[model samples]
Target: MPTAAGHRAITTASMLTAEGGLELRPRLSEIPAHVGVIMDGNGRWAASRGLPRIEGHRRGLEALRETVRAAIDFGLDYLTVYSFSMENWNRPIEEVTDLMGLLKRFIRNDLKDLHKAGVKVRVIGARDNLKPDIRALLVEAEDMTRANTGLTLIVAFNYGSRQEIAAAARALAEDVLAGRVKASDIDETLLAQRLDTAGLPDPDLIIRTSGEQRLSNFLMWQAAYSEFVFLPMHWPDFDRRAFASALHVFSERERRFGGVTARGQADKVKS
Candidate 1:
């Protein structure tokens, strides 16, 4: 964690071109390997414009397409997005139907392009109760892109972090009961391995749009030390510049990961 003055200094030193121009994009070395996004504000954006909420969601899908391309361009190893949460089922039936339709459309329309771009599709969340068609589409997306080795696009569909954690715990308990392992064998590592995001690295940065500052039940277990960047713009308004700005903000932070930095050590000695 950097002090305010230190943050400003780092920003100034790292975000300047050799010719003294402002560089909005973060350097490649400063980029995080994984990023998770909580896309928000589609409904509010639609309401503000006096349009149907579905219209905003449609625009948000477009934003997601651009974001995937941008993430690939940025050389990010993994990009996770909170697409549809389990709680979203509580919305009006029509709205929920529209969202499901959008998911189908996105896969049917963009899956080929995604596979062609070398993006591996991975879906996380409980799928046992999903509609058969929806489940099949999810399976299709992953199967189509499983061999791609470029960017891994993790879609958190029908996801809730609490439920995910609880499910992991339950699975571990079942394994213990089955004599697969002793109670002492269970630890953070074992528990995390049972999680939906078992093989993926924890997100290094989590970005939320629509001015929201909370995780909203997204990636609670994995976001233990992730840097968050909350943007005021709605999900429909996100683009390359917005993504770049978040990366730039991330670049200025000092992630000590619970350890003391040299500056902190020096300040402690002086004090």
Candidate 2:
């Protein structure tokens, strides 16, 4: 394992010091093709510190910026993060508005750095629900990174697995009705084509921060067989060393596609 110099303070489950200096290490050359993260525990993290929930959210956004750099350094091909969920709208109006404002600021301020690094930015979710300017900014970011060749960044904004599946089903039904595609041909591949992550590969690793155990309506269909890591650290608390540990864990796992069952070391006994 590489020495955790620049990344330890960021990703480790350590308490923040009086000084807000956190070091982030550059990513290794070997990164997963797809990595999914559920950015949870922001409000809880704030509550623990006896601070307002919005403060935690503000910190979470800063962590997200660090995450982008970690993803790039890791040499990951795709990085998907759970930023806002369909259920997040249930929070207080002030909080929701604050998050939207932060999102806008992120676009205006962060896009330049991302564009320079060749990272593509895309948001997955319904646009009708967000504010007009927020929606516009999202579109602008996507357009700016449409031609980027580095890691593809997917931000799940106002996204839900159930809603995505319903939309895909509706599109397939329409195609079948119009005689464009055969009803019998509506297999996994056909359904995938209609999903928000149509062209992207299925996520290989799904990490849920804040020690959450459930999927929480994340990429249910796409993460059918993804390796899962639930980190105890909150979203804002998660940093580069934490990401490195996750990668290290991922490297040690032996995946089984239902064909062979791993026993000890070299044994792949048929189930």
Q: What TM-score does candidate 2 get on C-alpha atoms?
A: 0.87
Over the full model, what C-alpha lDDT does candidate 1 score relative to the true structure? 0.89
> Where in model 2 is the C-alpha error above 4 Å?
1-29, 261-271
Model 2 misses residue 68 by how many Å? 0.8
| Clashes per model (N, Cα, C within 3 A) | 0, 4
> Would you estimate the TM-scores of all the predictions?
0.91, 0.87
Q: Residue 123 lDDT in model 1?
A: 100
lDDT by residue (1-271, candidate 2, tens digit) is: 2211111212222334357755333345445688899999999999999999989998999888888898887777889999899998999999988988888888999999999999998789888877788888999999999999998999999999999999999999999999999998889999999999998888888998998799998999999878899899999998877887787677656566454433533353433
Instruction: Kindly report which residue stretches of model 1 are placed more than 4 angstroms away from their true locations once superposed.
Output: 1-23, 269-271
Model 2 alpha-carbon miss at residue 211, Å: 1.0
Q: What pairs collide in candidate 2?
A: 10-239, 11-242, 27-73, 27-74
Summed over model 1, clashes come to 0
**Local distance difference test, per candidate?**
0.89, 0.83
